[model samples]
Target: MSIELLTLCLILSVFLVFVTGLPVAFSLGSVSMLFTIFLWGPHSLQLITHAALGSMTSFMLVAIPLFILMGNILERSGLAETLFKMVYLWMGPVKGGLAIGTVVICTAMAAMVGVIGAGIVTMGVIALPSMLRRGYNKELAMGAIMAGGALGALIPPSVAMILYSSLGKLSIGKMFLGGIIPGLILSFLYMAFIWIKCYLNPSAGPALSSEETVTWRQKFAALRDSILPMALIVLVLGSIFIGAATPTEASAVGAFGAFLTTVFYRKFSWRMLKEACFRTLKLFSMVMWILIGASCFSRFYMAMGAADLVKGLVTGSGINPWLIIIGMQISLIVLGMLMEDYAIIMIAAPIYIPIVTALGFDPLWFGILFIINMQIAVLTPPYGFALFYMKGLSNEITMAQLYRSIIPFVPLQAVGLVLVMIFPKIALWLPGLMFE
Candidate 1:
């Protein structure tokens, strides 16, 4: 069969499997296996084996479970509750303060946990009720939590970034650095939108009543409780920036530090430890299986001259490279609506990275942009992970409300993406400054 026909068949086969509602890992693996056996007489199965083995043995992948363990431990440790208390004590007097504080706490949680599920659910359980009780608009309250929680995809120690950097053969430390600025930019945008909306329409988010406010002394006490968690963030990201540790080593430090936080808070229990480990194992196993399957699928596709075919089409076309880049971003957003962020990275990075480099774009910059797009994806309707997470938070929150909540922040995320795209320095400066 011609490469074009084969490529079309491959795409359709994957789509059909996805429609069948099979797990992503199995879908990719089964499709790749059937194609190999049919096209190459089963002899090519060794290639898939090697690819899966390589993914399993990767040293960088060690960080995934450790970071996950850290996040899980911290999630159960009451740190998010402490941070939310801190934000509430200080910001409650201002209009939209609770919603803005939700964003701030989510950003801090993103630094500590580097995953969205914990942040979204934790904040939803903690901050959402407070905002709603204080008469904050439901859409605004839900949007802030969803958007802020999505920052986990763009912030340091992000498992998504780790996987993207590993698959793209880029520096993990640099990719981590690349995300910091863009993540903060989006956080600021979310907070700004909340403040302005509440400022214009005070009914959307009213200042906390004086009776409900805390004393300045209580506010300071809450700040004291936050110090240890902030220190942990500094330790993890600072070590990477100063070259004191590889990303893997920093992950170890993070995991230990997370345990220490639990100890300090007296939240540690043998049962808590067991639960954290179990959660880590389950999440890491899911990620690794996807990695193995994607490795197999990517290997087969590349072996079939997929790279040359993509390069020829992209380079031979008279389209502007910038337009091509925009097209790729749009495609990623659409894919995000369908696939898990990890699977999208695994499948798309192999095909897109080469084209990005050939077009004279920095892969690191493009990787950060891809992550920002995912930030939007997780909050988008129908299949957005964050949207579902919000719905699962309470039976009262309908899917329709979750969808409407994210409408404003999705565009804010896009603005952040566009800024980074127009000025690569937004994503590249820190990485370049530190490494160069």
Candidate 2:
């Protein structure tokens, strides 16, 4: 069969299997294995082994599990809760104060943890109850938690960016730096959206009553609790941004800092350590397996010359380069609804990256745009991981409520995506300044 026809069949087969409810890793692997054996014989099996080994052994990829472990440890510790409390006190008196505070706390957690689950679950458990008790709207409160937590994917030190850089063969440092401005912008947009919504309808995110206001003394006490936690962020991200440490080294620092925070806060124990390690293993293993499957699938697809087909199809089309880029973004959003972000990246990056580069766009900038779409993906309904994470945390929240909560934030994420696409410098500026 022609490679193009084979590629089409492979795509359909994978999607069909996925529709049958198979796991993403197995869907990608089984299809790739069947095709490789059919096309190239048993000798092609070695490609899968090599891809697994190569993907699992990368030193750069080690940062993923380390950062994950750091986040897990911090999650089990009381540090994130304390950090949220700190922000809650400082912002609690203002309009929509708790939701605004949740964004600040999630942003701070994002800088430290680099994963969404930490912030989402942490705030869901802590802030969600408080917001509900304070008479805030359920959908608005839940929406703020999920949306803010999703920031971890866009912010620096993101595991999503790490995987993207590893697959794209781009600079991990540059990708991390590139995400900063856009991350801050999206965060600001989320906070601004909350303020506007609450301002228009005061019932949605009501400010604390005079009786519930925190005293200045309490605020100072909360600030004191926050100083050390803030220092850890500075120690880790600051080290990377200032060229004092590599990403891998910075991950080590983050993990160690998390450990110290647990111990310093008297939240440490053998059980906590054990739980953190076990959770880390679970999360890290899932990510690695996905990576292995994607690597193998991409290998076989390339061996079948599908990448060239995609390049030819896109480049040969009479479409403008800008339209092609827009089309690619739209496809990502569609695929994102049904697939995990990493799986989508694995399947699409190889095909799209070359097309993007051929169109004269910077890969690092495109990487940031892809990450922003991922931010949207995890908040989109049906299969959004962030939505599930929030619902899992609170029995009070139903799936329908969770879906309704994230609706407004979805468009806000798209706004951020479009801004970065149009003004590449929003992503590139910080990277250029820091790396130069």
Model 2 per-residue lDDT at 202: 90
Q: What tens-digit string does per-residue lDDT give for candidate 2 at 1-436? A: 9887897899899989998999888888888899889998998799888887898899999898888888888888878788878888898888898999999889988987788888898888899999999999999998998999999998978999999999999988899899989999989998999999999999998888988868899999999998987898888888889899999999998999889988888999989899989988998888888888889898888888877787788778878999988988999898878888878888888778888888889989899989999888899877799988987886777888888888899999999998998898999999899989
Off by over 4 Å in 2: none
Q: How do all models score by TM-score?
A: 0.99, 0.97
Could you tell me which residue pairs clash in candidate 2? none
The stretch of ten residues in a row with the least summed lDDT in candidate 2 is: 306-315
Question: TM-score of predicted model 2?
Answer: 0.97
RMSD of each: 0.9, 1.3
Predicted candidate 2: what Cα RMSD to the true structure?
1.3
Q: Residue 50: error of model 2 in Å? A: 1.0
lDDT (0 to 1) per candidate: 0.92, 0.88
lDDT score, candidate 1: 0.92
Q: Which stretches of candidate 1 lie over 4 Å from their true place?
A: none
Clash tally, candidates in order: 0, 0
